[model samples]
Target chain A: MAEFYSLRVNGVDREVVDAQLGESLLFVLRERLGLLGTKGACEQGECGSCSVLVDGELVCACLVLAAAQSGRDIVSIEGIAPAGVSTDVQQAFVDAGAVQCGFCTPGLVMAAHSLLERIVDPTDTEIREELSGNICRCTGYGRLVEAVANVAKTRIALGGNRG
Target chain B: MTVSVPTSVAEAVSLLAAAPDSLVLAGGTDLMVEVNAGHRSLDRVIAVDRIEELRDWSISADRRSLTIGSGVPYSLVMDGPIAELVPALAQASRTVGSPQIRHVGTIGGNLGTCSPAGDTLPVLAALDAQIHLRSVSGGRTVSFSHFMTGVKRNSRQPDELITGVTLPVLPGWQGYSKVGVRNAMVIATASSCLAVDESTRSVRVALGSVGPVIIRCTDAEDWVVGQIDWERRAVDDGVVAEFGQRCGVAARPIDDHRSTAAYRRRAIEVLSARQLRRAFPNG
Candidate 1:
């Protein structure tokens, strides 16, 4: 068995079971750390359900090894809220009625949050492109796109704050 | 076995050379999928993401070529300095999977995976890109044509890790096109890339997912180049369509779940024609 290590998740340091050489980050998060907000859908990299932020870059946790994340800051959907109400992106999803079926909402929120981090004022096309990896079976992505765009606009209007 | 995350190129090379059975993992976009699907069997994995040396990218001092780090992500290739140097490659990179996949997937991973449907393979084949490989022993370069062996296979030794891909900086027009079920996050049914060199009065066309490896349509390229009267006439639609048909015929596709051989062949023809038109719009 490999030695366990301390990992920074959502700014909190927690010890996690050391991952085997090839164990995916998704498995470690869901199975080991019990961070269930990061869903595991289509273990294949196609679906964005396992999406997470590693050092601020959006990556498919299902496609990345847990060992590769050493010394990196990881942010999962569970980490999105430190206090209470969900992140602005999550709130926008509800306000825009973009949460349908809800399985893909966390992934969509994480993807949208990643986009907002890079571009506070993303165009509709950019938002669509960023969210392309995330699949929303119920909403058909019409409202999801709107939600992301709305969040981007709100972020910019608030001088880059969701508060 | 424990995974080794080497921080430098030398460390990575040493580790790989020491344990020839260790697998090199960059991006892990393809490898992880294979492993999770039980398609690949491996006992030891070496994570290459932390190797800063492999991530170094810069143009040669001569300014006659571009050296792209094997670890550079597809997103960087699509929007970074490499885009200006190799527009066709950038265009192809843009069509790989989606933004998330692009953010993590590396061109080196594409080469290492060596899939016939690799979006960037056709462009590299058409551009005659060179792959730089290194091991504890030393370094050597191989042409794109020689690097890939067959579907999901390559000639790279287990101990050798790709360091960079070098593409010559030349003045020419290039175009790439891929046919898939949908516009986003779909693998290529068939793809083609075309490069037209007005100075040499030559053209190069490479097709993917239509054969075991990216195939060059030398006969059709020569035929098109011979027929083009660059100064007097433009390349007509009929000529372009004929070129596309010839390029399509060069492919040997097989029926698969994603698409049928017939559909892939037909798509090859259309993609070939469209790419030629885009590469040589005036002709």
Candidate 2:
């Protein structure tokens, strides 16, 4: 039996139908809600393509069941830049030529955003550690790290979390 | 296909007892991986992550042990108070899947899966951790060694739920080392943990991903403890080499797809020696 779930996604109260709590939140967001920013790949939790923030903690959406997340706050990549407005991390990625295939871009952006929020200025090692979970199959990681480092500098100069 | 999200351990225990074969979902890191890969069919699941009681922890009144809830996430266990008590477990937890995986993966899930490569198992074995399990029938505790019988196999009855694990906080130095093809986000090709008890003047070494279950080198432990000065945390090169040799000998590695038997044995030796050096850095 399917149940209705009301999820606080991207600062909006969204309702999803035919919600199988057993299904991944990724399915609900992409297929049901039609918010495709949070990519789904390697559904085994190895790929961070489906990374999202549930109550401010970053988790792989594929590994997390929807039923377990009812009435919870979820911040996806789509929500990170409200109303399609670009975030600093997004701009930095474009400026630094970080995206090659662009499939892993959203997740990397979100992961980098999460780090910058906490670590206003992260070292190269910290950036590597934080973003290692989000794989860029195109092997554009060197520029990805450079882009994230570039944004961290901008965020620190602008004085913190929200720029 | 029922997904029961029990808010309490008692409810979970009853649900699991009612459905003996129901999969107990802690972090869902391993179970979901199997489900996604079409490796196993998940019929019914008892999701225990929501149970707050299963996520709590407390140190023994005698101050000799720490008991962490089965549902405690690796992120929590690897940081702050828990890490202070068992640094070896903390280091092992840090090496688990990734930040996203660690955010939700629990010590209980590592035990439940009973994978020989499980990063926590070797640490638990070295610490001689006691696993506490409960069911509607009754509650009992088992040694970490006794709990895991084989790869992805455990003595845990379907009706039973892991309540928590009680690890003795011996006055000692603890260290862990894991070898993998990549620096991050890769499972251990081979891993080893070394825990030295200062009070008892004992040394225990456990090798991971090199056998059917976490292999504790009892002879090597006795040899290392006997050879080293417990007070100074000092050991000669010969003692370290002999201890590593024993660990290499004890590892029952095979030519699995992940690694060759010879490479796995060599890794055990290298990791064992490195972890011992870390446990007694000055030595």
Candidate 3:
């Protein structure tokens, strides 16, 4: 029942071998492809810890079939930045003290990236709503919201450039 | 296990007919939950999201009906011409899970799951939308009332695939409301959709999560239609309260983990009354 397939992730074509069709995209990404940045918490879509962008749309990787994502473009946490390089959102998280346990950071970062990509200068309410799917057990949402808002403000100051 | 990715409706249906037990995967919002929980195992899954025919939608030439494809995601329903034509559907779509969930969850998935708490069910029921199904055998359309059989149950056959739903675009106002544990990322404990058709001088109300299936409050609908002045879009406060009471009486909620039966019944009354007032601002 194992299948072989290739998925375009982070602009790279990666081949997955001997994977169960029932295995989730989250499992395949972490276990098969060695992409551990996307955390698996609550296995269900509720936790949002497994958030990823498949075809530029934010979704819970735990809720997607590994084989079904064959032809789709997937962007994982590890793919978002250069090796050991943090983006503005990641830097903002550190500046705003948004990283506590760090388990939810990657998912939160992905959600924040998705929001800013669509709405460069998102309001506080928009940021909160966009990140609502992600849960930080540390209960550090206030700081997370602040981090996203600061990034949005910086982007606005730069004339809507997501640099 | 094997997975089939069909790019067309014909291929999808033929695959289903060939392998009737093939699990249909759309958004994976519900099926993945079960899979992750280890409650079910998939031997064969047919991914239908790739079918462009199931993703496309079209409006009737007369502008009286809007047919939404099964694979149309809730995010598309949140805002657009579809939202303008069926505001109630948009409202219901907004209440489904979260922004991430809305991105992939499809109306057809909601219909396939047929959970009583499915947000879009009440709106579809109130609108009297027709569910279209197709198989290698043929195609047939079923009304929303008969489509859902019970909680997480439907009339869809193993060989049939839900192609789309046709909703009538009425002139009058329509809206959807729900009460959950919290504002976002929560399932509805109780929900209601109220829609009015000025052309037909009719009022329709449907309740969700308070019954085994989407409960159409015919008593309340018939009573409200008589009480409202269609030309003025007005009704009496007492009439609205009575309609709400009737809607509450129609609920078949049970005490469960999500909510108490009494609370669900009360939520239905409050939701129906509020929706009735909002629809008839002059009340």
Best by DockQ: 3
Write down the DockQ of candidate 3: 0.84
Instruction: Give candidate 1 misplaced runs (Cα > 4 Å).
Output: A1-3
Q: Total clashing residue pairs per candidate? A: 1, 1, 1
Model 3 global lDDT (CA atoms, 0 to 1): 0.93
Whole-model lDDT, candidate 1?
0.86
lDDT at position B72, candidate 3 = 97
Top-lDDT candidate index: 3
Q: Estimate, for each residue in A77-151, the C-alpha lDDT of model 3 and write its tens digit.
A: 998999899999999999999999899999999999999899877888888888989999785699999999999
lDDT tens digits, residues B115-220, model 2?
9999999999999899999999889999998999998999999899999999999777788889998877888889999988888888899999999999999988
Task: Please give the ranking of all candidate structures by TM-score, highest first, separated by commas.
Answer: 3, 1, 2
Ten-residue region with minimum lDDT total, candidate 3 chain A = A154-163
Clashes, model 2: 1
- In terms of TM-score, the best-performing candidate is 3
Which interface RMSD does candidate 1 score?
1.3
Is 2 or 3 the stronger prediction by lDDT? 3
- Listed for each candidate, the true contacts retained, as a fraction, are 0.71, 0.57, 0.80
